[model samples]
Target chain A: MNKIFFFLGKGGVGKTTLSASLAYYLREKNKTVYWASIDPAHNIYDLLSLPASPKVQKIEAGLWVEEIDVDRYLRRFLEHIQEKAQKVYQYLQILNLDKMFKVIKYTPAMEEYACLYALKEVFKKHEDKDYLIIDTPPTGLMLRIFSLPFVTELWLKELRHWREEILKRRQIVAHIKHVDFGPGAQLEFSKDKVFNELNAQQKDMQYLKDVFTNPKKTFLILVINPDKLSLLEGKRIVETLNKFGIPIKIVLLNKTGHSMELKELNFFNDLPQKKIPLFEGPFPKQVLLKIASLWVEDAYL
Target chain B: MVLKQIKDFLSQFGQGFKEASIDQIQRELEEMENAFALLICGSLSGMPAPPAFLSLCLLPYMERELKIMFSKTIFLDDKLAVWSDLVEL
Candidate 1:
């Protein structure tokens, strides 16, 4: 079973650095690890001194890394719909829906969907790896992506119910009219394309929801600076994830001042905190590996 | 010409009779379709839309419902447009 570690917090909080460190640390432990940067602004390649490429590259014996091309994911997501739409909606050609395919990239929550698409692709492709370290975007976008599955799953359930009702009414209308609406007329859930699509989407959403909220499989690590603004965002992240039943396993207080107390921040008190002292960096591979070793030793991973 | 007119009248009458046989249920079915479309493509009506990635897949199966939706909206200015007949068209 591949365990996933997601590193996220407010912007400029060293998420990429910390996630890269963890990926390195895990690889050192002889675990096969895939490091994915889901952030729109990627830093893993530059930080790792590896040439920047969206394609996954093997940096060493056991590590694979990619800065996910998020827009490509968005394109793929839309293209699947456009392809299906062109096929199933052959009679609707006059509506000129090609514009819709181009325009839907600007849809609300589209960035989150793209990020989720990237994450899902990683999960499907890298299931054989031992550990998957996800380097995520900032607080707002990450929260939406995290909540997308749970919220949409609930909506899908409602859609399924309504679809059943619609199908039953179709049966009634068909019977009363002595008309054959055909086997695919949605008289049954099994033969209905809409219903089956709804079910498949719901199942995918539920799978993601379960994996996100499941502690044993996923470690939700929050990295925050010891600043007031970052802590405020961190508090909201914790509250929102709690609302969705995703428990944070650890808090990495990166670039901390001399000494800070979790007791001072009540929301972060329950979480296991690893205080990392501020370090000046022009971090080479050796320096980064050293930092990873230090953080790994006390993080209780 | 007289015979053709009678044929048209009988065709309209037969269509009306078929509709009258299940008028209430027929209306309920229409309502169901509109509801399904609103839920699936709520963005069209300024309603909170479902996730586009998921809903787009359902659009291929929504020709009937979507036509009902558009017929109403496209004729919103015409109060006597008889949108139900438009649905038949």
Candidate 2:
């Protein structure tokens, strides 16, 4: 139920720097803020000069920063799976199922699922905060993460049917073995445990979708530089968000070198026009502050 | 103990699972197809994972998929592999 702000764009557009400064500015206004980075590259530490730890680091009066360590999260998630699977294995007397599950846990989406699970935990546990600002990964990965609830839902449906069939098959096997069909039967063939955890995860994804799709609560600010590639990328992002039904609240053009001519500026007119002045120097605290002030002025209006 | 409680809680939704509609399944399949298409296109174009432009194109389909996936209750551990595959996208 808290307001969530996402600073998203292609990489190298100062999304992290902008997000950090904005969080700082919001804190100055006496609002409790939790600025989290969902980027796998882990640049928030270097940008903010904070230690690489998951616990919130107080940067100002009411602002705190945290980074999601995907690997660690994945390790923990896999460990949970291993623990649960071990319980099932021990109960069923199945040999080597644990090893097979370990291999499955190492698959590609495992890390992403772990990261998302971490996001769900944070949202659920950190309810007292006023603002939650997210520094998402670049557009593509971030979109996949954002859209995961949708994609996973389809898989879940198919999986439900498949699981039921598997359960039925297990029951037949139990019958053939003349095993007593009693309370232990539930433990032997139940899909309820796995489904419940997934349901919880889907709820988290739904929370994100609700927040993201709502213009009043979640604002997607696209960050861009004044170059052909970045500008084109920004335009594409704008269009993509619209296509996905996620609102794009504003576009922040960062780090435009002072040498561009008037004709070059014409390229930006094609975009949904909200422009912030370009800073000339490196993205130090002062420059970040300036950007943050501009963002606050624009975002509030 | 928490895990057991969670399982017991989810078993309550098992009845609804029997009532899934075909239209919902078809709609979800379409969404997955679109997402897969977008990912393929983005990868071919060398675009990053959250390709801004293409993701916009994929968002609605993605949203549809989300709605379908979450409406009926499914457990987490069983679908971890499916989720892992999608996240890799």
Best by DockQ: 1
lDDT of 1 by residue, B1-89 (tens): 99999999999999887677676676777778778888788877688878877777687777667777676567768855565564655
lDDT of each: 0.81, 0.61
TM-score of predicted model 2? 0.64
Candidate 2 docks at the CAPRI level of incorrect
Q: In model 1, state the lDDT of residue A62.
A: 92
Clashing pairs in 1: none
TM-score of chain B of each: 0.57, 0.29
Compared with the true structure, what per-residue lDDT tens digits does model 2 show for residues A1-301? 5777888888888888888778777766778998899888878888766578877787777777888776677667556655654554454454465465556456545555666677777776667898888898777777666666666655445544543553454454444444432332232333344334435544655676676688777777778777777777776777767766887766777776544554444645655544566555446767677778765764442
Model 1 Cα shift for residue A232 (angstroms) = 1.1
Shift of residue A202 alpha carbon in model 1, Å: 0.2
- DockQ for every model, please: 0.36, 0.02
Model 1 CA lDDT for position B46: 81
